[model samples]
Target chain A: MTTITKLPDPVAGGSKHPQRGKTPRPGRGRRLGDLRIALLFILPAMVGFVAFFLIPTIRGIYLSFTEYSVLGDPTWIGTKNYTAIFADELFWNAMAVTLQYVGLNIGFQTVIALGLALLMHRVAKSTLIRGALLLPFLVANVIVALLWFWMLDYQIGIVNEIINWFGLPRIAFFGSEQWAIPTIAGVNVWRHMGYTALLIFAGLQSIPSHVYEVASLDGASQTRTFWSITMPLLRPVLVLVLVVTVIGSFQVFDTVAVTTGGGPINASRVIQMYIYQKAFGESDFGYASALSVILFVILALVAFIQMKFLKGNESDLD
Target chain B: MKKTLGAVAAAAAIALSLSACGGSAPASSEAKGEINYWLWDANQLPAYQQCADDFTKANPDIKVKITQRGWDDYWTTLTNGFVAGTAPDVFTNHLSKYPEYAAKKQLLSLDDAVAKDGIKLDSYTKGLPELWVGQDGKRYGLPKDWDTVGLFYNKAMTDSAGLTAGQMANLDWNPKDGGSYELAIAHLTVDKNGKRGDEAGFDKNNVAVYGLGLAGGGSGQGQTEWSFLTATTGWTATDKNPWGTKFNYDDPRFQESIAWWAGLIDKGYMPKLETTVGASLADNFGAGKAAINTTGDWLIGQYQSYKGVETAFAPTPKGPEGKRASMFNGLADSIWAGTKNPAASVKWVEYLGSTACQDVVASKAVVFPAITTSADKAAEAFKAKGTDVSAFTTHVKDSTTFLFPIADKAAKVDGIMKPAMDAVLAGKKPASSLTEANSQVNALFK
Candidate 1:
């Protein structure tokens, strides 16, 4: 297609403007043609974005200020739904749970992923081990949750069996209030660590081998070389992983829904589950939308703060 | 790149337009009447398909297409369908959701259709016909089948414990003392060292098998969990039957019953809440890991199919009210208000609720039919299959039964109660948690 457009220009230059020995302005038709071609290139994406994302988001914001149950016509209720959510104790409780879940998930996933990446990078010969480690990441969230639900069962689970073998009492992983949230975070980390580790591994590989060679020449210890070279170079990828993970942890629903249904006393009922209950479970779409907007603001604020913090102070690498 | 983009865009536009126009409209005879019917239960699919075949044979012009979804997805998708204007011409409805749908005018009122078709509503079980009536006194659906909770015990285990049928059948219960039913559960619960739960030296932590299946921590309905016992204690879900605005979760009797139900965990007679998380109580019972299961009668066929398991059914134990009570709930076939073929759809619903079709369902014995005669036939068919379904039939015929709770904000009630109930069942708190939960439930109405 670019070839066709170029052909027209060459033809115009040779046949019509050759003797003038001057660079010609593109014809109005040719300029319009370029515009059409650009539009053609972008139209499909634009249509999808408008249809699925833009329209729904605008409508959701509109709904947050109105009273609607999906089945009936929405009534203009002003800011009533938003005010109600602010006053609702359950909403705040869900927010607190969601924050704790995000903290635990991000903290565990980052440490596990970076540690695994370091270990796997050292054993570079074992591609099969890397693939095997990634098997959990490939499994669907629901399947992972269901598998863990059984594995963590207090009586019949293999986990409890192993615990009993060591002359220790079995832990009620999902049933106990203190254990439920942390156990869920552990499961999320278990399922996601492989993917995050692989990302870090890619970043590690991108740090030129000569940099490590130079560090070895300097007689820097392994830990010292890592701190001076690898860590600084891995900053951007780390930020990317951290942001993606924080966003995802806030939206955790499938694992919680399947494993606990946010139970043993709402210990695992994160914000997404609460919003889901309000929207689909109770048919309170307006209130749900209000809660959703609040979540959106929270996530945006968190992401901004993270980006600011990550970019600030010109760390030794910068 | 430009031409490729144009081609891709054109294809996407075509696809979008095609999807916008997709999905066949509701069946009308003029456009080849092929009505879609939806239901949730996979076990009932074969029986319903057989009925659809029979309906098609009788009415050659209309074709019935049946689709099955799981229980949770069925309601979610159906509600979404109602919003999308793509709901099936006819679909199965539940008592819990029908009222809300009817209130929203999503269901086609079948009152005039029933009168015009001369359908006898009396043919269904006694309370079922009235159950389909909405708050406005309009009939929104036709009764299809009913179910009740019962005590399912492993016959071999009960017999080995020297528990006779008479003792099991005559057991009565109270909140203070657990009656003979508790004793039976204790006797059946054996530790890894061959001591019963009732024995002094029994190791509660090392019990090999629970005497009762408490799989899946707790249910909001209390259907199989504690509803039977609680109902027998004269506890009702709401102030009224069909559309009660107030719930009674904070009632003293109800709280006591839940406390006792949760106490079984301490006694080592029931599975811990954590152990129940992803386990199916029915599967546990079928595998002989649970000595008894208090659940709905719909699982009878599933248990009967287990090779080495010998199952027996008994009524829920009588309570302080001097009567055994169970939640009597039923399914109905409703017409979508958006349906184009109301006449044909009504015809299909009437047939589904008729004896001819119900008899097919009864013969399958997967579920008890709504029609009293069909229910009796189902019992005889089960007897022929070497299983008795009278445990459920008796609830309909003789036992004192309460209607399943229905309310405007039923889902809100659940959102409030389920976690609170889970707390009690998990032993984190007593049933007193319902005090705050009840306030939340009532707040929804306000």
Candidate 2:
């Protein structure tokens, strides 16, 4: 498994066309012999990725084109699945819900995570605080969802118990359609806030203390130091977080499945839940695949746009 | 290097083939070998093992090996095995799933097998055999047992309500406004805060125990909601498609059921949704917190282990609809079509369908025996526990149960129905909206 070369060969579409000297003539720089050896070195990983991730992804897209149930063979119905998805008000509703979820996750979660990261950097490096902060991330996602579900249960929930002690009317955490999404989003944020902070923390840690020291000596105020140095530097890490969190939000299934089950009437029904219910629950694999393709397209477009803007920010860093 | 690759690939191929061939039947001419059987219950393992023992003692050629798993895991593992074609020789099957599997030609149709062993559908209950038949009219399983819901009550709670066990044994409603039930519930109501449910001066909020216990946790066995309400409305759980096509949650009758159901929760007659959902349902009733809990026939053995609590059974209290209804479901033993020893598996089922084993199964009270004659054994066992279980048997016989159709889509519909039912019962949405959702679900079936 050793990477003998400093730079590995590009095996993007994979060993499907394994002509050793198959690189386009215009893009050739790393020689044929080097390419041959590099392909040999990367063959295991190249095969593994293609077999596991790439092929399935391609199949998923192809499936998005067709109608497939997980049990039986899928039939090619061309754009019918896609057409159904576009026409589905419920599916579109889920999409709007997902976009809202993504926006809140990226918009609110980013600022909060960055703020926490900044606070953590100011404090002395202590494992107690570091470990204590990362504890939420350590708990399994399903357990966290269940715990929050119990905490927020309307009638017998601890949340209502506390609220009732103060002689206030109980707010149903997931009871009402309005509160359910926010409550789910809140749980999602709590679970991932630690990971986001940790991501930005790593970015923060990489920026040498001398940069801050130099800024301080330049008479940079705490505000200036943060905006000028920290914020700019954290942009790369923040972009990574934003992209992942957005995608992760689209992939939110376990929480909704366990907590509300896409309910109070499909208010929290994200595309993933819909896709799953169609695919596994209903055995409408082709329809599910079509929904999945829509999900992929949405995710890809968002990622494209976000990263396009992010790449602009990143270039300013270099 | 080439030799090494070849050897590794060869070893892997050999290992796979070995596991693959492990599922095939041993040659009859050859010596005896062990066979694996999978069953779902943690408790019924012993009963099955005893059957295995009896089988092996008579026929020394096959040594039966049994691996126990819970229902959910068993289904997951069963699905995986079905895809892989390494499923067990004998396994438990349900009416919900058998039809779909049988339709796919996955299950070994026991028709020929039944004939070979001199077993007949008439040997068991009439309704039981119908459960194992798929959409194609193929008999995939032998009737294992059937389940019907019965109203179970606490003697202590009824005693406090000034009701006698004798009066309740043959209790009936006058079919007008459920005034008889309201009176019974009033007598059963005791106010911890000294406010009685029956008294004019009593406060509904201050009442302690409710007359009828409906549901505990969230998604119960569908007994509290579907049986009490949906049956009264004259609905069977099927859409145009086999999978759930209609979500009748928005039906006025259904909503009325929910509102009536909510009254139980509203009046402290039942535990809140979370408390009544799982193990705590049994525990809550066992502690005498509530008087009567609506449950299925399965809980009879389940409640037997409860400490300091002797349980009794009753029929579901008739509603204003004048229909005394019960939701009936049956479980059957299906043979795998791809089984190496289909003949032997059929032999095993013939044993299962026999009066001897059915009697044992009934005597254990694991489930309401699907066979009528053996079901008497279950009734006798329940009578020994001081609770008459004949209601389960008689209810199925007397009442016309709108049974689950073996549509290819039934299992899938159930998945959608459970959560939708949960939403309405939880009061997250008003009962009126259930019809809209139910219609939308019906559209899916269409």
Candidate 3:
């Protein structure tokens, strides 16, 4: 039988594996054939990292400090772009809208997703329902956004027709400044609902149903049983879904663009849209990169706090 | 079951791909390496294709490969190509965007090309060559076409309001007391309660239609719309104003113009601000939703689909300055400085400037020739479609116009202008507060 030999990366630090094979001394040539084979396996990935990811990433960070127009040589005006970005009211406004969007949809996507997941677990015996429920999630997000745009058009939209049928005033889903962000959030929720539900459904299925039956036998009601049994068990999956959804919400762009064009005045403008505008519409890449760096820091910080507060480790699963 | 689900997910991911990539089916094996040409107007490409065919007949070695995209996408792709180093050999240029590209040194200077081709400056409109000149006084493009802001009013709407075409044709604005055009606009304005704006004691809140439509807020900066307000109010966009970097949109006259524009929205004479930011003011007019749309002469054929709609052209309403003032704007054929063959590129530009090509381009549609002589063909093209474009020539003498500035800092100004106008349109900021935008833009320019 063949065994794989691998060395821990210096960046990753100390290996956890039981050392049956002798480790090579630092900077010394490899003595073992397995070590050479391991290197051969890892070489492609390391080359790819250097060629594609690391080089461009470093360059992008360097470019962030300059006011580049993409067409010409980027002139370094160190921190000027960053200073301008902070002073920009639209940048702040876009950040606020993005926060609102993330805050609004984070709870919504999770709640709706978990609710559907619970419902799916209850009805797990039905094959057709399980398959059909996920169609919206299966559909492409860009297509979903486009479909919703047409469905929400002012003059001839289906959403209006449906509301009119109910004797309620037709809502201007995409156009109105007040409703634009909410509309985008709602569509985002609708698009992701099925996939998130599927994730929680898998998580739910992993939990033995005997515990639920035990609770029922102990005279536990559905609500009481869910809070006591399901809530504790789904913590790990919930944390994962929440983290991903929050990140996704912060980066939201295409839908807002397809529907509103940041219109009725910057009401639906988001950070990514601002980045896109500066980078393309105005050809101000340096400022856009500054925005990007800000966004990256926000995402990283948020993710860190989420990891700390939510306790995503295995010990918290109990 | 999990394995099957994984397969389905994988299939879905595969389906998620399929970006509309790949060039057209490879052309017939020909000697002249295919030159990539980007264009926006799908309606106008057949003539380009015809021109390409004619050009190919003369130079069999050159195959003009054309890629048509929307204006928004065209700019997006061209800008992306600048970074990727895969930009097309040739593409259309606009006054608003040329400065940035030229400043970046992305555009090739046509100075040598123009001289070599013996292309005389006298053939173009006075000061027209300045449109393609970068901030450093480098000429990067040759003038392609000229367009001046004017008014396109629905004759049917005016006739129904009991106004004659002759009166509307010469309609001018005096921004001082809301000129004669505003008076007529008031007369034509209709409310939800069917009250006319000109009627004594007419209600403004329940307005069903606005008589005059000048694109406002973010879109007011649109060439025709903003030019109408600024030129009439005596704000100079060119010649005297070297600070293309900062707009005086915050000045008293400009603010008053903005207030007047916003008043149309506030009074319910026009659509709500949210309703028309990036939305088509053109489509609004064509649907009989609005009566008077302030657009350029080029929009003459754009509204032809509106059945039986008799549209007439008029100069912008005169402002406090009087004299029905306006600004002239135009487009140019720019060469990218980073191009592999600057010589080959100018030959292409010179060909575009040639009367034969301009005639071909003009004969096809309502596009006015940048060349003075071939403009009649464009006018004739419009006349064939049963619309006279003679009004375009008449206003050139009186209008104080310039192309949209291409200051190296154009991107910075736009960044400031978009949000500032957004604030004004949303009513969060006063129109006069645009001085903040002006200062921010000025900072970038310096």
Candidate 4:
């Protein structure tokens, strides 16, 4: 446990001074040296965080209450943008569509990733296999969307060609309102599932092998061992994965933008696409900022709930 | 902690100052300096490069740097540039966007310069120069080129369908019965069972070749899709164009025309709206999956470029007005208000709008220059390439062309109309649904 706590602190090793008295409080000189070095090391990252993340987040929040058209100075509009968004049918439709996509993407991704991770843990632990599984995640989102777009085309795409060969009607994967969201979700799942599986695989590796061996010795069936021991031990990792993936799925944009452009008639207009259309397409940056602020609040609340309800910080092994 | 705070503050100060320096405007306006120019069309880049070279030769003090980006990225980057004050000295402007930019004072008014230089606005094609004049009576840009829509058909498919060149050229349309245009489309469309759309036992469900390729939902403007049809029915998009405060999308004549256009999908004369997404209509026509495509003259080169497919152009069919109609859209060059080399920028724009540059552009046969003589030269160039572009030019000759609708909140208008139009095209809702969308668009103006 001590080693585990110290594992992430590489600076701790160099900070140890035999000349200093063995006390909880280090000598002033040594402390100063450590502080300076630590400050120097983290300064670049701190500057980036402040400049890109913190400042923009604050500015975005401020701009949400204004009417900025990206051409002229932003004007104070108070909560008008928010009020309009609340009453906007398109905004509600976008939210519903985004939720549907998130549900489909995360649900399939989590189950498939968990299955792949288990298969890797029990059967094929080769680095080659892991790398092969992760290839799709390495490709750009736009490229993946375009590739699948052609492959799933209604008339001449290879997938539809196969469907035709099988004497089934070709599916309008990206074109139909009913299939657009599911198709986008499916494409993203294919791209992300491999990376997700590897994350779960890492969590699996961290589980002490002795626990599994002891369960076996107790004459525990594989199913019972998985349900009682493995499941609980994997809960924290699963929670983290869910929080990350759910947040990611909510912001689904590139695939839909490249493929559907929020069509077959608002059938696949996710929140991000709607925000993008407002900001860039309509030059309504204030409305777009407000939309993003809401998204941020929702994500924050979701993460907090996930951490609290799932007890994601606590581990069964601990 | 104090030392750390001081160091962090210093670092942040350095970063902020660096960014400030990066955003600083160039030295004061000069008639002789390097001027950055930007345009969206890659095809016109080389032609413009030649123009730039010639301009540099004539005025060695002024060097031009040209950049080109695809359509979507061009507008996005230009908008960001406007905010950052790093926009090019000159850029290609569209009618839909310039109105907004002019309203916001992002565009430099070219009226004084035009008057000072004695540049004749009458040299440009009729209605071309007036498009650049803002609501405030300021000329924001100088017209460069113009485009109009026509029917591009697969010649082999049309010939096999027993359609003659004369028959294809003289086709007429009406919203009530769909006229000879619909008949041509039906005769050309073939099913998997090798039956024409007009033939008995024709399978609309399994169309092997759509008679008319669906370009898109045509959001608001319907420029190439149904604008010609709607115009022929005397159904305008707005109460007045340019700065029109009201939209007329709910007009029964317009709705009926759109309904007739959408009905083609059900009849298998056109592909489903869903099928057109992410698929190029020109490619569909080239692949023999579509027999005919109604598109702008700008795509003439692209449609002609498909190897092994013999393509030909025909004038848009005559409508109820007893004349064919097309949306006459033109592109122009405008100077950015934030430019440091405003004089040089205006000079470059003037040269671009002049016959000197336009002739070079026309010689390439890529597009029709705004100048009447330059446009004629372009037609000859097309003839030299063995492609007759009279189908597109005829609308201009017959004065049946309508101005491309220009208005404020154009993007918002498109946003409201795209889905509404898409729903109608997808057969999920009737054309009457547009009446609801029309009110929402009108509300934006209010």
In terms of lDDT, the best-performing candidate is 4
lDDT of 2 by residue, A135-250 (tens): 99999999999998888766557888999899886676775667778888889899998789888899888887888899999999999998999878777777887888888888
lDDT of 4 by residue, B1-446 (tens): 12223333443443344344332223244689899999998888999999999999999999999999999899988877776556898999999899988887778788778877889899999999999999988899899999999999999998998899999999999999899999999999999999999999999998999899998889999999999999999989989977898999899999999999999998888988888877888888888889899999989999989998999999999998798999999999998776767778888999999999999999999999999999999999999999999999999999999999989889899999999999999999999999999999999987
Cα displacement (angstroms), candidate 1, residue A111, comes to 2.1
Give the TM-score ranking, best first.
4, 1, 3, 2
lDDT of 4 at A305: 98
TM-score of chain A of 3: 0.86
Give lDDT tens digits, candidate 3, residues A285-317: 778878888898999999888878887654323
Model 4, TM vs. native:
0.91
Clashes of each: 0, 24, 20, 0
A160-271: candidate 4 lDDT, tens digit per residue = 9999899998899999988999999999999999999999988988999999999999999999998998889999999999999998989899998888889889999999
Question: For candidate 1, what is the total of clashing residue pairs?
Answer: 0
Best prediction by DockQ? 4
The total of clashing pairs for model 2 equals 24
**A3, model 1: CA deviation in Å?**
22
Candidate 1, chain A: TM-score against the reference: 0.87
Among these predictions, the greatest TM-score belongs to 4
Candidate 3 i-RMS:
10.9
Candidate 3's docking class is: incorrect
Query: Candidate 1 clashing pairs?
Result: none
Poorest 10 consecutive residues of model 3 chain B by lDDT?
A: B18-27
lDDT of 3 by residue, B57-167 (tens): 877767777789987788877876655556777778876677667655567666655665688877776767766766676676677677776777778778888888678
